[model samples]
Every structure is written in C-alpha cells, then in structure tokens.
Target chain A: MSVFVTVGTTKFDNLINTVTKYSAIKAFQDLGYNRLVLQTGAGKIQKELDQLEELDKFTVEHYDFKPSITEDIESASLVISHAGAGSILETLGAKKPLLVVINEDLMGNHQLELAYQLYRDQHLYYCECSTFVETLKSSDFTKLKPFPDKKPKLFVDYLDNLLGFK
Target chain B: MDSELGVIAVLIAVVVCLVPIFSIYFSVNRTCKTKNPNVTSTKRTKPASVMIIAGSGGHTKEILSLVSSLGSHYSPRFYVIANTDKMSQQKIEALEAEKIKISNKMEYSIHTIPRSREVRQSWLTTVLSTAYATLYSFPLVFRLKPEVILCNGPGTCIPLCMAGLVLKIFGRDLKIVYAESICRVETLSLSGKILYYVADSLLVQWPSLHQKYPGSTYIGRLV
Candidate 1:
C-alpha cells in the first residue's frame, strides 16, 4: 500500500520537504508502505522527490495539484495532510488514518484548535514540522477513532422545525 | 437671523431622515424578538422558496452538504456566489444534477455578486466594495423574495443577510439563518461576528462558541 501526502490548494513547502527526507521514507517502509504519493501544491520539490526515487528503497510519486484528490486519498493506506478543514474532513470522511501537519506560518490559531479538538477526540494525530518524524514513528494509526458520520438529518430537521415545515 | 433659519432648516431635514432610520431599526429588532421560530404554522401544499449563499472553498462544501440534506418541500432554491469564485458554481451544478437523478425534478437558480474583498486587499477598498455589494444585494433579495435564507460563514453572506433584513423591514417574513463555519472552534469568523446580531437563527458547531455567544445555538458538527 501507499502513503498519500497532500498540502491541499495552498503552498506548504515545510510539509513537502520534511516528508521527502530519507528518514520519513524509511518510516513509511517500516509501516509497510512501499509507495509514497505526494500532492505537493506549488512546492518545487519534484527534483528532490526524483532524487529520492532513484534510491529504489520504495516508490515515490509527486504531483502539483488535482481537481479532486479523493481517489488518491481513498487508495492510500495512510494520509499526511495540511491542517486545512476541507482536506482534514475529506480524509476523515474517507475513513483513512490521517496525520495532519500544521502550517504554523499561516495566520490564525483556528487551524490549531481544529486539529487539537480532533486529536483530543482520538480522531486524528497532529504535529508541527519539527515533530513530524517522531509523531509518525510513535503514533498508533490503528487506535484512531473513526470520525463521526455526517448527520445532515439533524440540520434538516432543525430547519424544518424552525421553518414550521414539521 | 438668516443663517440661524438656514441651520434650523438643515436640522429639520436631518431629523426627518433619522426618524425613519431609527424606526426601521426598532421595527426589525421587534420582529426578530417576537417571531417565534418554534411555533409551527399551518402546512402549505406548495414548496418554500429558499435562498442558499455559497461562499468559496470550505464554506461552499459545508453549505452544499447541508442543502443536500434538505427535503423536497424546501425547493425553488436560489443560490448566490461571488463572481470571482469559479469553483462553487460547478460544485452546485454537480449537486443539483445528483438531486435530479434521485427526484427527477430540479428548481434552482444561481446568481453572482461582486466579491467584497480579495485576499490581502486594502481596508479602504474593502469598505467601498462591501458597500457596492450591499447595494447590489437589495435588488436581488427583492426580486427573489425567498422565504428562507441559509448561509454559512462567508464575506459574501453579510450583504445578502442585510438585504434579507431590509425585506423583513418591508413586512416580509424573510428568515435568515447563519451557521458558523466548523473551522471556528473558539472564536467566530469575521462574517459570523457581524451576522450574530442580525440572523434569525445563528448556529455554532462547537459548544464553546455557543457558550460564548448566548444568541447562537449549538448544533452538532454539520459538515
């Protein structure tokens, strides 16, 4: 199986760089992930990825972006993503083991709040770029609780009652 | 004596303008307080007209998911998106197509308004653009006359909600519901902060937000 790493629509060079390191590749291999698929948005890491691919330790694939990463996310055994709510929810919706890497440079601490809340709920593991490797090595992906299912019915019923449809 | 009379004339004009403005404000507030949303009115045979505001990116995703959950009675959906956002239209169309497959009936229209602000835009320009958008929303809101407006956190929603308020002032029972984006855990977004005072029903996904803003209801994770 492969490990999918996505930075969503924004440029996140730190995440792309950290995961491309030999240690990260070895860690993926340790987890039995023989292929690494990287969705590197606007990060010029293809050259480094190619160089690592030549080592023949495991397969390395890289792309800039796609209209939808759902297919890739579904196929992968594990997903490493930026702390954007959209990507986090999509990965969680796909019911995959997700390791969210926060882009601390971005303004606002809401991303941290979302990641922390989910982490507290045992739904996902989150880390900064500095602790990427350690978190990967130490965290138990199997123990992660599946994110609660989307209950649109609650909202519909609420609206219907509020609007006097019920 | 002539200058004093001119000053008096100007004061009268100012008071005349201020009277209507203050009256409208109090009238809107009274309507907001007195309208009991919990009281179920007599059921109608016809579908209710709804206006859905789709913001960019995650806002659009969350709003659409909520829309998909709605029953057929809340139909003839009117969608408003920013002209600059190219992605939300396609997503809306896709969702509508999916709805048609299930029900074989589709009633929705999409409209675009000028974006109030772009990323990194100057505050001065943002003010002017927002005012322009607010003016643009009045006609759209008047034309649609939607009974209900559903919006999540987006800069675009503020102007539309204002328009809905205007309709309310004109004796129309337009209901505006604003759902704070789920990304906001502790604090509300800029749009959410503004809509807190205006929307008929303000919803927050996180309990902390609900506790912080007594006006907002704590609805569990919507998207």
Candidate 2:
C-alpha cells in the first residue's frame, strides 16, 4: 500500500512531528509501503527534513514546491492536505478520498470557515493539525473511494449549457 | 437665443464655482484617512503592506483597478510589470496618477522588462521565457518585501508571483492572493488553478469561477 500525502507548504513535517516522536517515525519504516509526505511549500517549512534513518518504511521525498494542484494530484492513492479547498476538488477529480488537516485552529483560525463549510456540505473529512496523523495514518486507504459522484453533479455541464450559446 | 445663452451662462457659473470645490472636497475626503496608512481593514489581521503584480494590458488594468479599494483597506503599493500593449501602458500610467492625485497616495512602483510576446509555441521559448520571467521577478519581490501579494492573472502575474509563493514557504511572511479574472469565466486558467493550489487565499470575481475553483473564495468584483 502506498500513501502519498501532499499538504501544500510542506509543513506537514510539523504535523507529523506533532503526532509522533523520532521514535514513531520508526514504525512506518517497517510497513513496506512507499510512504512519504511531499513537502508542498514553495519553501517555507522547516529546515532539516532529516532522513528518518530510523523509519525505513516511508521514503520522504522532498519535491520542489510546484503550486499546480492538478500536477500534484496525479496518481496518488490518498490525498492529505491542509484543508485548503483546492486539494478538496483535485482529490474529487481524481476520485480519491481526502484527509484534510486544517491550520485554522492551528495557526489563526482562518480555515475554520471553509473547513466547516465543507464539513457541513458533507463533501470532505477534516482533522485539526494536532490529530491529523492519528486520523490519517489509521484511515483504511486500501478501501478509499471517491465520494459518490452522486446526484448528477453537473457543475461543468451546467456552466457549458448556460454559456455555450452566448 | 438670449434665454438659452442665459441658461448656458448660469450652468457655466455653476461649474466655475463647483469645480474647485469638488476637487477640494475630494482631496479632503481622500486625505482624511490616508495620512495614517495603517488604518486597518477587515480583510486580514492587520493593515498589510500589499504588492499587486500584473502583466501589461488588461491584466495590468485589472490589477490597478483594485489599488484604490486595496489602498483604502491597506497601505497598498502597486507593482506592475509593463505588459506590451500600448493601451495597457497608457492606462496603467494614467491610473497610477489617478491613484496618487486622489489620496496623495504615492506608494506606486512600475517596472517594464521587455514583455515576452512572452508565451511560446516551441518548448524552448516556453522554457526560456519561463526561466526569464522567473529570474526577472525575484529581485522585484524581495525589494518590495510586502506582507501580501495579489496576482491579477494572464501571462505576467504567475512568473514573479509564483516565485514569491516559493519564497514565502522559506519563511518570508508574505501572504499570496490570486484574483482570477473574468476572461476566465469559460475556462479556468491553468495559472489560476495553480494559484488556487498555492495561495494563502484565492479570489474570483465571478461566481462561476468560484464554482470552477470551489477551493477558492470569491471576493467582490474588481473595478
């Protein structure tokens, strides 16, 4: 099983730090899946993405921060994010379930509005930064499926039909 | 004819009396708040020093369009990369003046680095211009050192602005905001979506763009 976590701004390193010590970074090493968090920040996160010489299960690949979400979403089994709305839709497009970690409460509560809206809309699942790893690492990603494209969600079609003639 | 002349004379008299008075009123109204640049806005936590970057023509115009409102909201510094269109150049210059004359607000900056025809057909030109644009904007962003940067899209904004996003990640306290344009009403531009992925906040003037980038927040129309 491969888990690709891309929370733009690579500070997911901070989130992972919050979850487990340098010790727990060991357990994932033994799991035998290509586990890694693509630090998505343009450059602002922590300094040393030191090798988890201890946890060999995940190969933490530090991808240069490219802001294109479409490119980021390509071929990922699970999408983990900072509850930014862009990630939500891209994950939906790829038909993958998302694990969102919100910085609203972690940083300044700016995300609470959007995160709450999505939560209420029942379109996504969110965890605060503090509990993100616990919630994310435990997700049954093997069974992950896109939230049903239920009820003829014709967003693009509706726009096309309205604007096509004009 | 005399009556008509008399009416015209009266209108002229009114205009003669009102012109300077209106100007004075406008001056006073604009200055009353601007003398203190930090007259905070409800948009963000504090009154941010903002840099709004855009390409030459429509993109530049659209970016300038927001300056007045943004200035009213923050200590806005307009940074424009002169797009090639003459109309864009003239209008942006004109708007820059208007921005200054009204509020006595003079925090405007303009830079024109040979607009690329900048997009390319061949991969080489694309890569070269992309590289050039990226290299070009690096110094501009560092020099301005704004707390927040807004991009009004087309070709010009992404280069300098995207680099700024990368800088912010490295611990620059810059907040990146992208205002996707109306031209994108039909197709959400790839640049806009990329901004959606990276921006601290993404804004769209139209509701459809908002729907397209459901991840974005819709701020009101720009101009």
Candidate 3:
C-alpha cells in the first residue's frame, strides 16, 4: 500500500520533519509499503527528504504544491496529513482513509479541535506531531469506520428559509 | 356669431385630445429615465439570483454544498472565485455535470477576480492585490445585481463583501450572508473578523464560536 503525506497550503515544518524523519520512513518500510508520496507545502524539509530518496528499496516523491494533490490522495491507500480544515475535508469528502497529525504551533488552536472531533466520531485517526511513528506502528486500520458522507440539507434549508426562499 | 362659437368649440376639442397624449408621454419618460435602477421589489418572487464566493479547497467545497442546498429557489448564480483557482472551476463543472444528469436546468455563471493574498506572502503585496481585487469586483457585482451574496470564511471573499457593503451604502438592498468555516471551531479567521461586522447575517458552525461572537448565529456543523 502507498502512503501519502501532505502538510496542506501552510507551512508545518515540525509535522513534515517528524513524518519524513529516518525512523518514520523506516517504520513504513517495515510495514512493506512500496510507494510513498510526500507533499510538503512551504515547509523547509527538502534536504532531509532528498537524502531518503537515495535509498533503492521504495519510491519517495515530494512536491511543494500541485493542483493534482487530489489525484495523489485518490491513489494512496492511506493519507497522512496536517490537520488543516481543507485537507481534512477533502480527504474525508473523497472517502479516503485518513490519519491527521496536529501541528501544535498554530496560533488559533482550531486544528486540535477539528482533529479531536473527527477522531471522536471514529471517522479518521488523529495524533500529535511527536507520536507519528508510534501511532502508525500500533494502530489497526481494518477496524476504522468508513467515512460517512454528510449532506448539509438541514443547514442549507435553514439558510434558505432565513433568506425567505421557502 | 355662430361662426366664432364653432371655432371656439373646435379649439376646446383639440385641447382635450392633446391632454391625455402629453400625460402618457410624461409618465413613460419618468419610468424609463428614473435615477434608481433597482426599481424591482426586493421580495422574493421567482428564484432569487445568487452570487456565491468560492475560494480554494474547503471554502469552495462548503460553498458548493450550500449552492446545491439552495434547491430551485436560488438560480442564475454567479460563483466568484480567484483568477488562479482552476480547482474550484473544475469542482463546479463536476457539480454541474451531476446536476445535468439529474435535471438539466441549473443556470450559473463563474467570474474570477484577482487573489487578495497568497499563502505566506508578504502583507505589503497583499494590500495592493486586495485593492486590485476589490476594484475588479465592483463591475462584476453591479452587472450581476445579485439579490443575495453568500460566502464562507476566505480571504478572497473579503473584497467581494466590501463590494456588497458599498452597494448597500448606495441604497441597493442586497443580503450578505457570511458563514464561518466548520474548521474554525474556536475563533474566527481574518475574513470572518471583517465580514462579521458587515454581513447582514453571520453564522458559525460551532457553538463555541457562537458564544464567543455573540452576534453570530449557530446552526451546528454545516459540512
């Protein structure tokens, strides 16, 4: 199975570093993963990723930002991303299995709320930046619930009625 | 004496015939050259024309879902997006395709304005770009003359909302609805901060934000 790692539009240096660290890549290798795609947006971790690219065992590819990030997300067996709302919603919207890692350095502290809520709902796995490798190694993916497709009909009706449409 | 009275009767008949003609001309001219263009009633009659602001990714996704939820009441929509946002255009087209499969009657237009800011870009450039975007949006808003404008929290929506505010100042009645993104459960984003004051109605996806911003209405998670 392929693994897709993305940090979304903003910079998340710590999350990128922790995920692309030597030990974390080794953990994926131990799980017999053949392909790994890393999308590090504005994060300064290319040198570390380049060094890992030298190894011949598995393919490692990285990009800053691309319009085709959705295509990559679709092809991957699992998506490991920073807890940005855009990334989280897109992953879940596409019905992809996801594991969101929170970057504690965000100023507003909303990412933690989103991650915890999704985790509590059993929609996807959530973890902190430091515990990347540990969670990957111990988590059981087969038991996770499929992402529920939520239709916003109620909220839509509320707004429409408020606008005096009905 | 009888000849003079006949002439007098003929003159009075001519005056009576010209009176109604002159009054019709004056009334038609008044309506045709009225100063205010928005003479139509603001109340919803047929489907209200809607203008929705769509940013990249989550903002666009949420706005699209809201557009779908509008059902058949809001039609001939104008989806204003950033100039570089091809993803949003693609998503809209995909939705349009889906709509056509179900029913072939969705009428919408897409307009692209300059981006207000890029991620991690300098604030100096952001100010200039935002000014340009706001200027560009003015004509689009005036031409569309949408009865309502809808947006979630995104920097691109700021200029469009500013345009709506200006229209409101000009006595054009337009409803501006700003719904905070569901991702923002705790606090408002920068765009949310600006629109919270200006929007006709402000909605928050989380209750905590509703408590924090007392002016905002909460309707649970929208996405």
- Please provide, for model 2 over B98-199, each residue's C-alpha lDDT reduced to its tens digit, 9 standing for 90 to 100: 767767866666666444224323443444454555556655665666766777665456655655664564456666777665344434554565456677
* DockQ, model 3, C-alpha based: 0.27
Any idea what lDDT model 2 has? 0.53
TM-score-better candidate, 1 vs 3: 1
- Superposed Cα deviation of residue B169, candidate 1 (Å): 1.9
**Docking category of candidate 1:** acceptable
lDDT of 3: 0.75
Of the two candidates 1 and 3, the one with more favorable DockQ, higher being better, is: 1
Please, what is the TM-score per model?
0.88, 0.43, 0.68
Q: Pick the candidate with the highest DockQ.
A: 1
Model 3 per-residue lDDT tens digits across residues A123-155? 788788788899989887776777656657767
User: Comparing chain B with the reference, what is the TM-score for each candidate?
Assistant: 0.81, 0.68, 0.78
State in Å the error of residue A42, model 1. 2.5
List the candidate numbers ranked by DockQ, top first: 1, 3, 2
- lDDT for A67 (candidate 1): 86
Q: Docking quality tier of candidate 3?
A: acceptable
